[model samples]
Target: MGKTYCHPAMKQLKDQQTRYAPKERRLEQVERAEQLLGEIDRTKRYPYDYLCFRITGFRPDNWSALMIEGDEARRDLRQFVEDLSATVRQPVEQATEPVLTVDEVSKKYNVSTRTVTRWRRQGLVARRFVIDGRAKVGFLESSLQRFVAEHRGQVERGSRFRQLTDAEKDEIIRRARRMSQFRSGEVGLIEIARRIARKMARSTETVRLTLKAYDREHPDRAIFGPSTTPLDDDAKAQIYLRHRMGVSAENLAVEYGRTRSSVYRIINEVRAQRILETKLEFIGNESFDDSKAKSVIMAPLPAPADGKAPRRPKAPKGLPPYLASLYEVPLLDREQEAHLFRQMNYLKSEAVKLREKLDPAKAKTAALDKIDELQEQALAVKNQIIRANLRLVVSIAKRHVGPMNNFFELVSDGNMSLIRAVEKFDYARGNKFSTYASWAIMKNYARTIPEENYRRDRFVTGHEEMFEAAADNRIDEHEYESALKRMQEAIRGMLDRLDDREKMIITSRFGLGGASERTLEQLGRELGITKERVRQIESRGVDKLRRIAGEQKLDLPML
Candidate 1:
């Protein structure tokens, strides 16, 4: 053969062409494999194993190709193998571990084999199987130690794991024997078995078997008969009656034939059904009148006395009657009463002046607007009065401080009474405001006091009648009589002390027969003197009255 030396450039070009073709083919294969693997991963289980097997078959017998591809594939395959090994080993590791047999467990705890078996069945202890048909039962050593420690007092004195003491086991056996003996007689088999199981630390079946054995051993001792004095029809009827009347379960059990538990169950069932019925009735009858109830409980004030005008009593000169009585109840001195009366008169006069500034004819046309404005001002004054009344109620309520006293409730009731008094008061009445409010105050106190005793009950009833009568009469007769007497005495005394001009001034200012309470200016015009001169004469008259009062040691009644 001719010298087969190829050109270096041609050799290099051929090698490059060969290498590039395989690289392109490998990249395409990689892309296809990745796409297929992604599809498999999305759709099916065991994609890694499937893909590995598929790729292996695709390049069968190609060692170089397989080795190159296998390096990348082997990494994922190794991970899959590790995962599979863990899955397979977990349960196997759990199964092959040395577990205590039921007998061994029973012996360790000094309990019967049957008790261990029951514990395994109840999942209180872990269980395994052996080919020999003996169950491998186990509990964690720590758990076993903990259980032993918890019940160390009950364990046998000489036993290693502190299993049941011989004395305790013997006592349990004795109780079981007693229960088995009872079961052999006419007692309930299940209940007797359960009792034996609890006492012996064994299964119910074991107790039942023991009971059967006992019955067989002592056939002559075993007595069988129906329960004597079972619940009769009359007893059942009495139970039903008691249940219907809402008797307690314990009481019902003592009286009736059923157990306390049974009575409770029956009563609860009935109560639940009754509750359902009540709910249904409430839903069906949805005609409840909340407004009607409110109206009945808190009735609105009666329409103003006359159809054309609101009933507003003339402003009184002294404290309201009710307030005066409340204050004087604690025995306020005459000077204190007079001071309070003068302050009240000043407030009333100011209110009257404010009212007079508004034109009456214009007010009639814009009555609603005027009323709203007036009511706002009135509300502010009323709030002050309410605060004062609250204080009075507190004082009055304190007087009732003793056993069975509730000052807050008494105060609350008094407040309501005070509100009613304010509503019904006719300011036009010449009596002191406190006297008019007295009935309301007493009514509030009476409502809270129990009517158990004859004296208190009679007083409460009479007071209620008196309130009703006063409301109807629209005039406080007692107050009117007192005021009339006071007025006569005051006029007589003043007439004796005053000169002619002073007498006329006093009489005209008071308007003895009608329209009482004239201003200084009005009196000045009538007496042909400047208002200043009239004021001086009025001051002199007041001074003379005070001198007389001081000399006679008499306190003038609050005007």
Candidate 2:
């Protein structure tokens, strides 16, 4: 411990050692290669190509040249081996952080590639760099830690965080009842919760969950009381009848202490049931029992009871039954019909005055209410008239029954046509309503026959022949004939607006002057001009006439 110091010679030795270390390492590698070559030469059993591959980790294309086959060329073979050793490169091991690919991460998490993609979307993983222009996903070990940390919390499903208390459930039920009453028996759980959530300082989900739990716990409870009770069949049928009589669903629900949804459900159910029953009754192949069938069929007049005059069968309920069934609608006498017509005229006048005074686009609520009221009254009057003339549809339907075979089907079609006739009928025409309706009914029935089947069976017989003949031979009514005459006069007046030459050319060309139609060339000759010039004048005059006709509200399809 007295003096542990390096000498001057030791310092020089350390410098020398450092300078020769790299050269020494290179020499050792060369020595190793020489020993391997010596070993290969001794083992002649192994092919030279195989020896070069094992020693240098590469098989040269020309093993003969690389090996120097003759022993005399051992020096050249050594030189070749040296050059090969210098040119060959050893593979290097790179120090890199371990990465998990999308597939590997999916397997590790027991999930799918889609889940890994979702993690990337949620910023749980960083995008991996591309290799060879191809995109790849590789999550670093540290990124997985972030993913695990972010998704580690326990989660609640559905709308519940904890169990609902008894008091909370009772409160929800009470609020729901109040809401149903306020809405006039038109309440649902969601609607009730939306209204009560604010007052209770809770979410709609909480209120809904409480109510749901209450329902599960107390099955015997009244729940929403009368509003929640399902309607009976009698009540359903009455709802349907009233709805047909023009009551709104909202009003119906309020009157019946039920929800609007329940009202609509009841009405649809009854209508479907009635339709099914009707189809079952009418579409049967079973033969009718005479006594039962007679009772089912309605008569226009029942036989006198105890020598009293006969009376029509009592009016049926609901919609008029199928025409094959008994349904006697009360008819109107001349006096009653006259009174209704007078009332219609007065109502029409009042309605016209109201309509003239009101602007629908800018009307106030009161004006709209008045308009609706008047319309309803007018509709009621029209319905009375339609019901009175329903027999007319049946009478005509009976005449067409031979071809139609299904009497009920004919009656149904006739009834629809009769409704149309009612909508289109003009009381100011001074013609009988029956006369107008007959034409409408006959036109509909003519179209009712299946054209495909009618064409196949070319023969016409029975009432069909009579119908065709009547349609062909019937004369136009005086009202329509007079209207035609007025239309002709209007056309004559419109023509007079043109110059004398134009009027003469148009009248002669179209036979409008009660003469044979003259050709453009003939007119051109008479007028001493080219047919092209005559054609131009004719077009001009026709255009003028069309403008005039449109102004007069004439229904001219050709124009």
Candidate 3:
């Protein structure tokens, strides 16, 4: 028999058909087989013998089976074997290789097609083959598995992929609200954004947008106005105290919950207003006092409403009419005033030169030599100047009394200026000695007033303290000198008791006579002894000195 060939389902159908066939149908089957053979030859284009041989086991008796089965059975059997091979190959190939298409892999990995191409280019995936002129790409199963496992952590935490937790979303919402409020100065937007971003580990801008959305949804609770409010009087006072006490603005801002700019504005405004009010009040009071004094000096005078002229009193007993007329006279022409000013300036220059020629130090010595001859004249001149400028010192001291005291010091300073004015006096200058002295005294007084009061008390002003410290240093120096002299005397007395060799060695070694220390060798050579012997003798002499110092209850001098 020819090799039996059958599809499992087809074979079962054929068996059922054969079992139903009877002997009377055998002749009909034979006739059908011959007809089928004829049809197979026409359709399949095969010779009858070849087709019959393929279908049946090459036997003359099996010719009818061959003709009946023919190409239909052969075609079915070939299809079944092909399908079985495909089924076996498919799972085997799938086990070793990836079944996913490039597009599918990209979607699975959450990456772009370009990214997948890049991975293939970088050898991250296996090279592909071309089928039917179309590029067919694939990856090894192990490679895909490893790639997925390696990047799983990155995928889970990727910015584009990861979802924010409830807390993070809430924080972002809060920040957005703050940003919207911040535009109106209602909230500290920067701080709020910063806090939210830190908690969420996100960018500040992200938090800012979130806050803005939150603020839109809940607009009523938005903060507004300035970040800070104006300080109360007590707060102002506290700030002033801190400023006066020299607290830094940075530190004050931290303590007061304000910015440096706010604190500075308050301090400066308060100080400036206080100073302006004080200066204005002082000027007003001074003007009032001046008017009162003028009224007392020239009583029963009519007050001038326009401030054009001084209301003069009736002439005093000692004044001549011409002198009074001169006092009241104003230059009628500008030329006359100019001429007088020129002459005054010339006289003033000459007077300054003459004043420079007189030396107070030399004058004091010269005055002693001719004391009896000039004493009376000097006393008379001094009395006249004092009588002329009665309140000169008081006026000079008043100008310096703003924030300082020490009236007597101001007076002594004025006395120096008065002496200089007297020496340089030029009556022809059209300016009196009192007027010149007034300028000099005022200049010196104003110059001495410090810009800042470093010392709290007038008695302990910086300059005074400096002088006191210098005087104290001088006293300390005197005490030190006294002690040093006593120590030298004691050392000298101790030296007298030493032997001549020891004395010379000790004196040279310690540099007692002059200001140079001698080496042991130099001292030893000078004394005609070995250096070692000199050292020994020097050591013994030191011990003896210590003993003598102990017996005399004296402290040995330090080296």
Candidate 4:
């Protein structure tokens, strides 16, 4: 229901009296209202008749009274009056202490601290005061009770409003109209609102709010115009065109006297309209789903007579599909190259240490096997660097791909030189990898052309002599094999001098003791000890073997 007021001063007086009323008087009203509700419930009489009879008691009815028929309706009225009376009495009980802290108010109302702050902003809260020299907000007991009573029905009904009667609203609008007339004059909005507020015996803020609401209701005829004046078709077109020509939103907003967001919104609307127009034109007489456009485009080509997938494009000469695919591998940045370079150095150092225990006679297989594993890991890091800088190789190779050298051959040779550069390139030296790799790649390409020319020439004119010269320089391959076998056997004999555990440690650490060489950590796991402990054992074992070999005067390879 809308608000009803008999008179503003009378209403104000009633509110003040309710706040300062005696506790006994408020309680007596609550009790009397309850008694009337009970009588209506027991007798099944109309609410208005009951109220009139109770007010007149034994007196006869003088005029026809408003009839409120229904138990539920009468009960609701009783409950509302009872709640209001109880609320009024509560403030009297707490008359000695009327202040409340923010926390206290939040707790009583079962709301968050933020909600309490918002209530204060919305003028729903009681007056604020300072406590303990700190600025704080406090809702009086009377104010809180009043708030609760006002909201009780609203809580159940959903729709709610701060009590403002139609007459009061009309008065506010009339004042707002007066302000609007004076708004374009020398009097500013603030001064006009203040003058109207004083005349109406209200706050300037209230007048300001009422004026703003009135303006919104009549936007075109508003005193200050609309909050965001919309763009016309021509203005929208200008925004779209200027934005496309690289004009910034800030400049456009300033030029048009609008916000940046407003200008951007207009531009977006124009673009969307244009897109829709284009799509409509395209769909004339026939239609297709834009979402399925990708699938439509990717409709497969017809299969061949052999019933197989189409063959891939030819890879570059001497480059298999797998190797060529590596070209697509992600390139490493400076940090990545530096990190990989560190790992490579560590692996290299470990490999050097393992090589010392390599038995040339019996441990050749084990030693070479482990060394190959370490080399493979080091090669992985090298390949990453190579993949990243491969573009450099291609650019250099492209310049030399002509008469004497094929593009593929130059690329392959350039790649090999690139790998060498990755291994030696020191990022700490502060030189870019591209600069170093470029010179190495170019030098390789230069040598490649001359070598190709020489090979072609030798094939054409001196094939027989070249074969004779190669044959004359050849050594007995079996003699080299036999000597290596003897050296491995001698090394095995030296290994026999150490104990079984020491021998095993030496073999595994160098790959001679196991199928593959093991890192100290790997050996420790297998031996059920820590890596540091494994290192100590290996060191003691190696020292013992070195001494035995020295005493024997056996020309053992450096261990």
Candidate 5:
């Protein structure tokens, strides 16, 4: 299900027979594609309209500009040229179109006969016929030219093929690391690295590894973001999440300021990644392959109809907000559990089947897109299963809590185990998923939670895991809190430099006296002015305070 990590840049030509065939010289089209591939500068961005004009000679209205990587655009275009020749090139009169045997094409491309076999299965037509001496099994030369137009591995490789200098690696890594600060949280770090790889005419892996090596060397400064990075996985994952929630790529494109195709590209990339990453190990059943398996086993089970998943349940009386919110999703019934498990496994099976048709070397966009759709469907089904079972993690974690085990930490580990069990559970065996998940959660808690820490009694969430591998910052809680105390103590006197209104605004804006910081609007409401005016006064007060701090040598948080 993991798709080829190709940026979407190709648009299928309309009734493209003429362009692909081209006045009895289809071979020339492949040559044209090769030329176009060479002309591509991977670092640059091309708009949809420009790409259409360059590849298909027709510019449409309102095309996206600079939305995808130059290398991916070239890759997709070259693939399309080859696919066109492979799928559409008919086997004409044998005498008219010169024959090229599988061996001959393989030798020419330095590929194995196996590769050509895959090609033939995809679309290239071949025939067994008598040739000069006896008989030869070969496809039309025109077909070979059209279909075998890809030149991927040599150029699109990583460090294995390319030799980048230290300076070159450093530049790419530095730019990439800087981008990772904000972009790695979700925006397009992978896409950006690919662009640099193309721009430098290096393999994409070269850039990827350069960034990775830098990250390994500087673990704290890694480009993938802070450990709490799930808030934004990637633009592709974000787009997929929204799309699963019923947002169309076209509308999302508008919302995200990308071309519709780019949005779809992100979604497909994420979906394919998820499917490929997931291990769909379902227990096989004879009924699974039955002709009526889908209709019967996959029949709509008794559960919420579309749009009927449980809403937020009201907070239970006399409970803390955190614990109460845990009850938002209702538990699933037996049939619903069976339905979700079957749907999840079935969707994965179908995706894996479709994945057989997707070759990373030459992915068919339409097929990949279909795989994405299936992946999304599977994910939606899997999520329903997860939601119905999340509370179960918390329930079991409570029993296993110990002196060393923080409840939240145990719950986090148990939740991960639950997700894994869901993916690994076999619905065909007719066992309840809850039982399997419960076992998984318990198994995870059986491990010892760390018994020692600098601050063993610190009441906090599970973020301490990051500190285990953190660089030698060495500053413990007391030292950090002591530093904060000093800053707070110093800030009290810094307010004296400001006038009455200025002092009030500064104090209120910063929550200096322990009341929650007031917003510009809130300050304006109290002071009888517009929020913008309040902002102006706050700005002046901050400037005066900064100057006063500089004059008095005060070290505060703002300073």
Candidate 6:
């Protein structure tokens, strides 16, 4: 407890977590941080995001499910409370109860400082505080009384035990080495420390700290093999994977012959490695850092409670089947559009906030996975918005359709404009999304409709102009032209006999009318059908053409 240990959550609080630091009243935050010591169960591990949410009432931007516990979590939170209390702009007049410094507690209870340290090892809660410009350890009056009431005998007999001398420490180290060396059945430092503590009649923490101090002072001459050495990248990865799979740090500490704190440090270091290695992109918004951002941006969208969505206005009678389907999609009210846009932007803003802290390698499925989850949620919300407004695309397309431009093709182009509008629209401006989308679609049509008409007219010619063109000077030209005409006549005659769908599939597949041949997948996307369905239609059309040729006794090449 005396030595420095890196707590995992402390760095993440400054790096990854969203802090709820209100400038007006930080004393309440201090009180909340103090209350947490009793509320949090020390035995269980918890996600850092969930912890942040509980403390700050706001979910972090990169909401993760990384679980942390044991001495690592406890020490981090204690230091967090310490730092939190230190930052109170005004005096903390409303502390639930008075707190005593380490010296004060020792003097008040007639116990040695070692006994106070031992009391911490025996579950007497203590926190760090900066009082009168000096940082000191303080114990809550309530926590002290609780510890004393429970361990009266231990508290009363405190400091009667003397501190370990150099000889006793050396003897303890010798015993630890002997126990570890002679017994080769996966013995850890804890077992060695406990056995030595029992034989020497000292607290387990005292024995443990003595061995650590010795190893740290003389790194090359360590008692616990390579346990104190920094783990390789691969070993850190393995430990993190096991943690993701629900292995406790305690178990990892035992298996790796390291303290739980060391194991947690490695796990977070690997976490920091992955977060640094990943590439994340997001649209940043100033709204995310606001105090009430999560609640306001993530406000629930209006929906029918019965689970069945009520339809919007019906399409005009005798409308095309495709246009009719568009009308079936429910429209989003103003509230929902705002909610979705805000949520999408907010989610990305939080991710960018997390990405901003990449400089520190002090702390991932949970982190990276949480980022991925946020993206997926944002996408789902975007799609929901796009679908609700699709009828707008059809309405605009109906106006843009010309004799040369296909109605469905105009609708298809309008869809791309609508998607871009959804991405770029700022819902905070308090305007109708459809109005924006309509302008976007018309702007696209303004650029596209003229190009389409010009291309179509460029290839068209009058009959008199065609007749005036000169013929090629080749041998057997008339016979060759006659044969080519017959082949074309046969194909045209058969094409007239098939249905509209069959004709379209055959023409698109074979590149008729000098158009480039289209694959089944491309055609399926354009037709709103599966590739398999397109293939089936093409096959059926070809079979019909072959049967008609056979019945008519027509000679068609490659039939």
* Candidate 2 lDDT tens digits, 276-334: 24311011112122445333332222333344443556544532344324345556554
- Locate the minimum summed-lDDT window of 10 residues in model 4: 279-288
Question: What tens-digit string does per-residue lDDT give for candidate 1 at 1-559?
Answer: 0001112221222222333335344333333333343233222334233453443333222122222133323223322222222222222234323445556667787766655544432223232233254333344454345445644643342133334455654554467557546545344544555676666665555555555555566677542222345665455556645654434454565344344555554444443333223311001111123434323322322333333333223433443344344443222223332233333333333334344454432332133233333333344444434544454565666676543444455667778877666544544344544665666687666665754244554654331221111222555878767755674575467557888887676656555544465667566657667778998997787577667666766544432
| Candidate 1 RMSD to the correct structure | 38.4
lDDT of 6 by residue, 1-559 (tens): 3222244444456322223355334455445655675566768877777667666677775547566774455555555655555544333233457978788888887766777876775467665555676656677798788779878866665645667888998899899888877986478877778789778877676788888888888888877655546677888899988876556676798787778887877776777666656654444567777877678777667675455677677788855576787787777777777777888878776765665663334443345545545655677678878888888898788787654566778889999999899888888779989999999999999999998888877976422221122334674788668766776777778888999988988887777766666767567878888778999998898889889989988755456
Give the alpha carbon lDDT tens digit for every residue of 333-415 in model 4.
Answer: 55455555555554554455555554432333345545545655556556666777776777787788654455666778888
In candidate 2, clashing pairs total 1
Off by over 4 Å in 2: 1-310, 313-321, 324-327, 341-361, 403-405, 428-430, 450-452, 455-559
Residues 1-559 of candidate 3 have per-residue lDDT tens digits of: 0112232333322232333445334223332333333334214433334533333323233233333243444343333222222222223242333456677677877765655654542223332333234445545455566555656543343224334577777757655555655554333544566666666665444555565555566667543223456678788778867765546565676466565567766665554433323311000112223434434322322234354554433544543243344334222122222222233333333333333343432333232223222222333334444434535665567567542354445667777777566555544446545567788777766665552243445444332221012223546777867766776688788888999988877776666756365666566657677668999998888777777778887755332
lDDT of 1: 0.44
Each candidate: RMSD: 38.4, 40.4, 49.3, 33.8, 21.8, 13.2
Candidate 6 clashing pairs?
Answer: 268-363, 272-363
Model 5, span 226-315: residue lDDT tens: 233222456657788877654655567545645455566666666556656665444455655667778765565575545476565676
After aligning candidate 4 to the native by TM-score, how far in Å is the CA of 133 from where it should be? 62
Model 3 alpha-carbon drift over 4 Å, by segment: 1-219, 223-230, 240-264, 278-434, 438-559
TM-score of each: 0.19, 0.26, 0.19, 0.23, 0.34, 0.42
Question: What lDDT score is found at residue 293 in candidate 4?
Answer: 41
Instruction: Give all candidates' CA lDDT scores.
Output: 0.44, 0.54, 0.48, 0.55, 0.62, 0.70
Return the candidate ranking by lDDT, descending: 6, 5, 4, 2, 3, 1
Report the C-alpha displacement of residue 437, candidate 2, in angstroms: 1.7
Model 1 per-residue lDDT at 13:
23
Q: Of the candidates shown, which would achieve the greatest lDDT relative to the real structure? A: 6
Among all windows of 10 consecutive residues in model 1, the one with the lowest summed lDDT is 279-288
Worst 10 residues of 3 by lDDT: 279-288
